[model samples]
Target chain A: MSDLFPEEVRTERLRLECESVADADLGERYASMNETAIEDGELAYVPIEPFEHLQEARDFVAQREDRMESGDAGTYVVRPRDGEDGAGYPAGEAELFAVWDERTAFMTFGLRKRFWGRGYSGERAAALLRLAFERLGVELVSVTHLVGNENSRRAIGKYVDRFDGERVGRFRNQHVIDGEPRDVVRYEVSKADYEASGERPDCEFVEERADGGDGA
Target chain B: MHVGVANLDCLWENRRVHTGVSLYRPYWGRGYAGERARALLSVTFDRLDLDVASVAHFEGNENSKRQMEGWVEDFGGREDAYIRNAVPRDDGDAEPWNLRSYSITAADYRDAGGAPEVELDPENVPEPTSEPTDLDRANDGGDGA
Candidate 1:
């Protein structure tokens, strides 16, 4: 149970590595990507305030480590498998927050501005959903985005639709952004829904891929 | 006179709270649940200055469903989602509950002329006017009634 999620999950185009404070380089990359998101004003759409200093992001990494150790969350750095160009750096972050009592987990992710236009959102989500359903053994995965965030609307919509998730309607005043109440669009994919979807994204655990290293 | 309880739980942020009402079996349908709910909404939107008041009921809890259906729209609320595995059971034997959820924004509350002005009092317990029913539990899931 403690080892429900793997250390690393690989999609065809991205590497989702578990966030670990023991790895100073991974911590640096995580903090650097966060700074980039803050500078790009991407944090405006997210619920959190921008990091005031580099150490804040580093502190956040340490906090996430505590959460992971408590079995309440799994945080991963999203990077391109091929480190060519700037894509090899931490492109974004993917997260799964457990609601263990209900057998459900919340899925959230974000990418730096430079990585936005590409299909990385869906690709990363594919890997995260596989972790939630296949590895974590949760009964349901839920996703919610601030209502006016059109980028997230499109990105979450595409991946959620492909997995046959239900678009639970726009909840009014579901969240507060910048001191103003705002709406949120929620989506959910049950284990049954994922199993029934014909177009689910392909993902493989790194160890599985290495073990089955076949020439076919 | 001591019926049950009403809850206004801070949910996501200060902007929203999840509200629910539960009355003992003897106090089932004298409209105490509705009256308390109306006052709770008044507090939620008017006094608390909160943005939204949300509530939900388990799938098979017809008593709560009827209560919500009766007044949710009159207060300008709407059904938000049917969330699967949303509530855990105290019994610990069966699966988590599938809930039918709803919410009312401050704007919606204002648009519907808001809940009728009612003063909230902690000691204001309603006197039972009807006999306890053996029909069904009004607050089966402890979520709402």
Candidate 2:
């Protein structure tokens, strides 16, 4: 897992690049994005609190780097490849958190308000799933979203199969949204299922090296 | 003779735990396994304050599967996943055994009237033996199903 990190994944329109300590400024921007309400009156549901200062953002990046180094998690920043004027600086982030036994991982993705409705969420999520199933050799990937989060439900529904009914257990009132207890719907996608579906995203992963050589 | 003991593996971050129980062959038909499971479930949900609990049994282990299903019916639990070829058999040459996982939440446990009071009668309890018996030999199969 450590050898797989610090790599670059290129989708058709988005670049899902691994995050490092050098991306502290981008982390600060992400934190700021979460602090403000979006156009839909929805606040980003983040496990951690919004960063109060640049130092906090830097700390967050540092911790993420440590987790990546330990092979416990991976974080990627989603951005446009062309870097055109109209293109956003950094759309949002995608993560494969809580990797266990090299076979299972928890996936999450978020996009800023300005970046929504541009098909960026689905693109980044597909690329992240490729990274999990192809490069990381993970067998099962699980995701959970707030029940009322329609945007998240739609985005995640495109990439994975729903694991509700008798197939998966529900965690009732696992989160509190707007001072009310909300159930989180759990979803999962197995490597076999993903491979059988024959729905591969147009993505390529390139390993980066400390030297000036392309580690493909 | 003593049958088996049920235990819990604590996973606090997910607010969940894994339950395991193994019984000797001589005590298989008896209700010792179920009795032990009830006590462990009480400790897991009532005392530990966990959100969910899970258990798994290997393929071809009908007795173990039946025991787990009984808990699901009692606690309104669900069969989570049917993991194919997940558990390897004791013999390396044998095909890997499929795994069936079941999970129960604390809310469901309460909805099923919760764990019953487990009473132990000292007079009926079997005394521990210093020498290894058939129970010890049976337990050598594995930690749990």
- The whole-model lDDT of each prediction reads 0.75, 0.66
Per-model TM against the reference: 0.83, 0.70
Residue-wise C-alpha lDDT for candidate 1, range B37-126, written one tens digit per residue: 788888777777767888889899999998897778888888998888888777435688999999888888899898666876657643
- Candidate number of the best DockQ: 1
Q: Candidate 1 on A1-216: residue-level lDDT in tens?
A: 147666567787877766555553634554565545456567777766656576776777777667667777777777777643564577777888888879899988878777777888888887778888888888999999987789999998898888889897778776677877788888998888888896556786653223221111
Clashing pairs in 1: none
Per prediction, the TM-score for chain B is: 0.77, 0.76
| DockQ of each candidate relative to the true complex | 0.42, 0.11
* Candidate 2 C-alpha lDDT tens digits along A95-182: 7764443356677777766777777777776777777778777666777887677888777776564222112434544565555555
Clashes of 1: 0
Give the CAPRI rating of model 1: acceptable
Question: DockQ for model 1?
Answer: 0.42
